[model samples]
Target: MAGSTKTKAKKPTVKKPSANKAAEASHNGAAHAFAPEPGDFRRYFDSGHTHESLGITPETLLDMYRNMLLQRRFEERAAQMYGRQKIAGFLHLYIGQEAVSVGSVWGTRPDDPIITAYRDHGLALARGMSPNAGMAELYGKIDGCSRGKGGSMHFFDVDKSFYGGHGIVGGQIPVGVGMAFAMKYKETGGCCLTYFGDGAINQGAFHEAANLASLYKLPVLLIVENNEYAMGTAVHRASAEPDLYKQAYAYDMKGAIVDGMDLFEVYHAMQELADEAREGKPALVEVRTYRYRGHSMSDPQKYRTKEELEAKKDEDPILRVKKYLLDNELATIEKLDDLDESVKAEVMAAVEFAENSPVPEIETMYEDIYTQSDYPFLV
Candidate 1:
């Protein structure tokens, strides 16, 4: 009876996609049934941009990686200092959003005015702000970019053309519009990068700024750094049309979305949009990113689960670029390590400099506050 038994059935074999590709099955599944699916998070220009197309060399790639690592290390150190109470007030650490800052900054010129919300340290540092000045500012010392007055929320460097660290949620949007209008007025042939969080995008200032930018064809790239949550609320709960880039169409402006975790995607998209903006074609770019840290040092971050954070880490922008470099054979492991070591040393030196810096004199506090005109008035 056993010898006459039927044969066993074999299991079905299915093909697997690359790490950079989402599951074809899910992507091709029912539209309403879609959920967050994984593959390559970066949506590169023309599907994927090559070094030849982007005109970048091994050194350039290495430099980008170095900047990202530097930002990461600097923030990590800043967190330690904050825990130790070296940095007072609100300390919003840009732990996972380095790519959006570094890549977008690189996509534009040094003279292109850059402005953003209070989470400003990353943007400032990426736009060539010295680590010493940045760290000193956090320490509330006189050597800080804003000279101990602005604290962690406001960092300014006129030379770098980084306008500020604006504290009022969407306030910087109007300032960016003014900057763009000036560029258009003077025919300066420059663009402005105005960045705000998903929460800030809902404010009146952002809408008004968008209208003015589009109406006058101002050279402004309005960027919404959508990191999923605004304070404690998810994006869906805040904005009706969560597709923020599409908001550009309301003002008759061009719009696009870039994966902020993908450095290549961010850089290329920013570059293209910036170039277009320089030609007086204002655009709104939604840079989808994630912040591993809480909204601020004070936040408990109970909105999301631990599994979500861990899963997102797998899409770390730094690791993404590193993998690209290694896979392409463009750089050796030692070279990358050396780059990282150099950055670490640099950040350490900045911390040392910040520690040694002196606090501003009480008398100097009232100096930048008021000025007198040459009027013949008796004291």
Candidate 2:
């Protein structure tokens, strides 16, 4: 007893209650349940109205028509080239979704940065990127905007501020945010128009970018070009909350849904949203548009029926704009026909230019690979 100290009795350890169970218990007896109100999502403008009321002149309408027609014709030719094996790699045609890009681009300033997913020829053309350059990029020619390196999905025009045709789903989200952040940091009086699809809205990148954009009040317009499908998967099947614009509510930002099939509606909505974005208010816009073709040239398109595709054709943006032009007496049928002929000719010339252009040299593969010069080891 004198040599050895008596051991103290060990106390039994007690496990603490689970925090999740405690939280549930605290709410168990509450009379009210937590329920969030539905977001106030509505079309901000009427699609049926004439552009005159919105201060869009006849000339501007004609330009919009021409740009949309140019994009359509260019894509048609590109599809033909793909079929002929003249153009290689993935060809994501922007057949029916032309209005979203054309109208949205027209709504923003010329210097404002614009970015979109791989279905991007329309956006590049709408932003005034030359068809020759775009087609050359598809042909992997030296005259391409990316020096014949980017192919169909990576069209980038630094001079026009067209950021890129990002190939990865939701890959452009944070890049767009970074561009907006730069604009804010530089006080450039410019904003960014970032476009993705309904499929991308489910990506974590979009949510993180949306949260950051809201937190920093970044000048960016996050557009969800909801064509109802992400590749073969339908939006309804993929998203638990199919209403994409409402997702912005979680970030405490403004959101709206528009008839992306109507050029006038898209133009007006984009105009207002672009103005808001330039004023440092980031917003989410869901453009309910549809694509006429398969996800890519290789797709068999077993997901939807021919009947569904035919039904959506009735709301074709190009045809709708053409009808509006005729109905409003903005342009006669003859003039429109002439304009269509001109666009076709232009597209054909672009194809010829691409055919004649030289392919990028093998050495070019090493160029434009890295931006940092300090990494001399790369050489």
lDDT of the candidates, in the order given = 0.88, 0.90
After aligning candidate 1 to the native by TM-score, how far in Å is the CA of 338 from where it should be? 2.1
Model 1 per-residue lDDT at 329: 92
What is the C-alpha RMSD, rounded to one decimal, of candidate 2? Answer: 10.0
Regions of model 1 farther than 4 Å from truth:
1-46, 370-379
Residue pair clashes in candidate 1 = 20-40, 21-39
Q: How close is candidate 2 to the true structure, as a TM-score?
A: 0.88
Best by lDDT: 2
Q: Return the top candidate by TM-score.
A: 2
The 10-residue segment with the lowest total lDDT in model 2: 31-40
Residue 130 displacement (Å), model 1: 0.6
The ten-residue window of minimal lDDT in model 1 covers 33-42
Candidate 2: regions farther than 4 A off: 1-42, 45-47, 375-379
Model 2: which residue pairs collide? none
